[model samples]
Target: MKQRPAVDLSELPTFGHGPRTPTWWGTLAFMALEGMGFAIAAGSYLYLAYLTPQRPLSAPTPNHWPGTIVTLLLLASLVPNHILKRHAEACEMLPVRIGLVVMSLLGIAPLVVRWFEFPALNIYWDTNAYGSMLWVMLGLHTAHLITDVGDTLVLTALMFTRHANSGRRFADVGDNVFYWDFVVVTWIPIYLLIYWMPRLD
Candidate 1:
């Protein structure tokens, strides 16, 4: 009589990046929830605009310069972001470290510009519904931007320490890159709704 030998799991990797990881799925769920929130906010803005056919915003058209700058910066960051993802996926420690630092700088740049963006909206949050919605949209994205930047900074710091070599760390970097892309993508429609919608009149 022959008996089947037990399977050995010891040789299998304990962690993985991308879809092979729980972190990846968690990131996807987080993005989906955040996306829903953004959709709801944008829907509200559209509803208000529909109610006011003559002048959707009923406020001065916002200065598009600050937002446009932010848009361009976020778009530009995609280049470095893809580079970082490549390094992370390859588990190339040196380039991942450098990429983290570069990404940290890129993350902060738009936040600094966003300081001016709030004012460039040409209305206060408390002024009225239109202004309130505008701020809500921007505020939502800003919150995400700040959170992701902090995550990047922390990860950058971690990559300089002993833990930098862990395979899980590379996965974390991939997640960070994924979230950063989400932050950038969500802002586009919000930017248009807040700035251009007012000018439609």
Candidate 2:
């Protein structure tokens, strides 16, 4: 057989350019919107507090203890979530999975505690202006938390499957972690406003 020169593979064109991937731009835009939403809600809570002559009504004073517990759990979840996000970006699956599971549990446990805690406060959405504001703020956050838990669960499942092998896995996990961090970061000020602040007197 005659000797033949090897063709350079790098010169060949690959299949049509791969499909476009999702970028963090959309996620950043979403976060901006969410930040505005929280700011408006928090402003409303403060405004309502200011408008009332007897703000932070003595009769409907919020209990600090329950809020304290919830705050602790939310604050704690941040650690694992941060770790998992870093790990996911590095394509380290085991730690990401462990962190996701821990983060999910930490995220949900507070809501469960709040379930019992909210009713015990004996304040209804219609009870008073303060009551209404508190409910609206907490309710909005709770909705976010619910969505976060679902997203984390989905990510956890994907981490264990072949789907995670796709190129977009990093983006998916990254976005989820970013959102989770948003939830945790946003809650800090909210906790201060709702839990630590002295009741309107």
Candidate 3:
């Protein structure tokens, strides 16, 4: 004879807001780990720079213009990203679609500027510790930028289809917006580290 334990399970709602869903927890976990990665990379940069008291680890003072432009573009993107987040929260399909298109453009613009940033560093990855750190930091952030942009493009296409009507898709959109904010926030200190630190001499 087998005994079964009975429990009531009928009252839970099938669909809930973004924060109530497992996907939101997954997204938060991902951001926390990624943020830790950025922190470690930044700390490494500081440690290496601290050791070099002479002439900035054999690299010239990098041009600040390209990184500055990218930072500005990233900051500018926050406006539309917040708008997108608000629309997603409201479950407004049309606005979400429009916001996706706008965000896709915003994501692409920074990526284009990011190319110029590498050259403006005035150093190569193989040079020395300073160069290597700068390249690694820039490369790490650039990879995130490309990844999130690709995701935005794909989600933009999805929103134009019948899938846009689904509530989960809207939560996904909110998560994307949340991730983009992280991407932008991480760049500020990195930009300063890569561009302005050498000039302190």
Which candidate leads in TM-score? 1
Residues 1-201, model 2: lDDT tens digits = 999999889965332111233445666677789889989999998887777666576545667777778778887877777787788667677777787778778877988877865764557878777778788778878888898888877877887889867646656777777787788788877777876564534
- TM per model? 0.95, 0.82, 0.91
Off by over 4 Å in 2: 1-21
lDDT of 2 at 183: 84
Model 2: weakest 10-residue lDDT segment is 13-22
Candidate 3 lDDT score at position 10? 94
Ranking by TM-score: 1, 3, 2
* Candidate 1 lDDT tens digits, 87-125: 999999999999999999999999999999999988899
TM-score of model 1 (CA atoms): 0.95
What's the lDDT for all of these models?
0.92, 0.74, 0.88
Backbone clash numbers for all candidates listed? 0, 2, 0
